[model samples]
Target: DQQVKQNSPSLSVQEGRISILNCDYTNSMFDYFLWYKKYPAEGPTFLISISSIKDKNEDGRFTVFLNKSAKHLSLHIVPSQPGDSAVYFCAASLRGGADGLTFGKGTHLIIQP
Candidate 1:
């Protein structure tokens, strides 16, 4: 079974609107959650992250919320701009120095004019 899951394949939002992406996981061992944004040909770059100890983390226009009890997490982008359109991947990893991360399928966000 896939440890991490992104139920929605895509989302459309108007410019200056809010964009929300959802993710779920089955592994409780995961303590660190991260969101990555990727463009057409470039690698995914880290956008935001939250630890299991905290319920939320925010950075500029991006925010990540974690619900450990439900094994769920979400990313929210407020006042989304055209440049914010990209594939967002939710990743989870155990707390360690070099452990690999498990990533969700990714949700493509489309911004309309």
Candidate 2:
């Protein structure tokens, strides 16, 4: 079974609106969570991350929130632009891991004009 999950397969938002993406996890041992954006025919690039100890982490127009109790997390994008359109993946990992990251299938975010 997949430890990380992105329930919504896709989302659409206006060019200047806010876009919200959600993710859920079944593993309690995960201590770190990250969000990545991937363009077609390219590898994923890191967006933002949050540790289990913190409830929120923000950078620029992006924000990530974690809820350890519910084993859920979310990513928010403000003033979403068409350039932000991409496949967003949620990944979870332990503090130190040789197994690498467990990633969700991803959600395709489209910015409509």
Candidate 3:
């Protein structure tokens, strides 16, 4: 069973357009959600995170929304830029626990200038 999944392996958008990435999870115990962006051959860096108690979180050009009832979450980047072209991975952790995280395969967002 896939604890976390990103159905789309890639996404492309113009430099000044909106870019959206989707992720799904099946584990009911996952309460902490995080999004990581990575460059080629590099480890993923933390971008944004949201707890199960909250529905939305934002930072600069990125926003994450969680729908606990639906077990889905998405990341949105406004005015996508060439710099935003990277792999985004969605991860989840057990609520209020410390056992690392489960990661999605990742979505490669390509920004066209």
TM-score of each: 0.96, 0.96, 0.96
- Which run of 10 residues does model 1 get worst, by summed lDDT? 92-101
What are the runs in model 1 whose C-alpha is more than 4 Å off?
A: none
Q: For residues 84-107, what per-residue lDDT tens digits would candidate 1 score against the true structure? A: 999999999997314799999999
lDDT of 3: 0.94
lDDT string for model 3 (1-113, tens) is 79999999999999999999999999989999999999998989999999999999999999999999999999999979899999999999995536799999999999998
RMSD of candidate 2 to the truth, in angstroms, is: 1.2
User: What TM-score quantifies how close candidate 2 is to the native fold?
Assistant: 0.96
Model 1, position 24, has a per-residue lDDT of 100
Q: lDDT per residue, candidate 2, 1-113, as tens digits?
A: 98999999999999999999999999999998999999999999999988888999999999999989999999999989999999999999997333589999999999999
Our model 3 lands, by Cα RMSD against the true structure, at 1.0
Q: What total of clashing residue pairs does each candidate reach?
A: 0, 0, 0
Rank candidates by TM-score, best first.
1, 2, 3
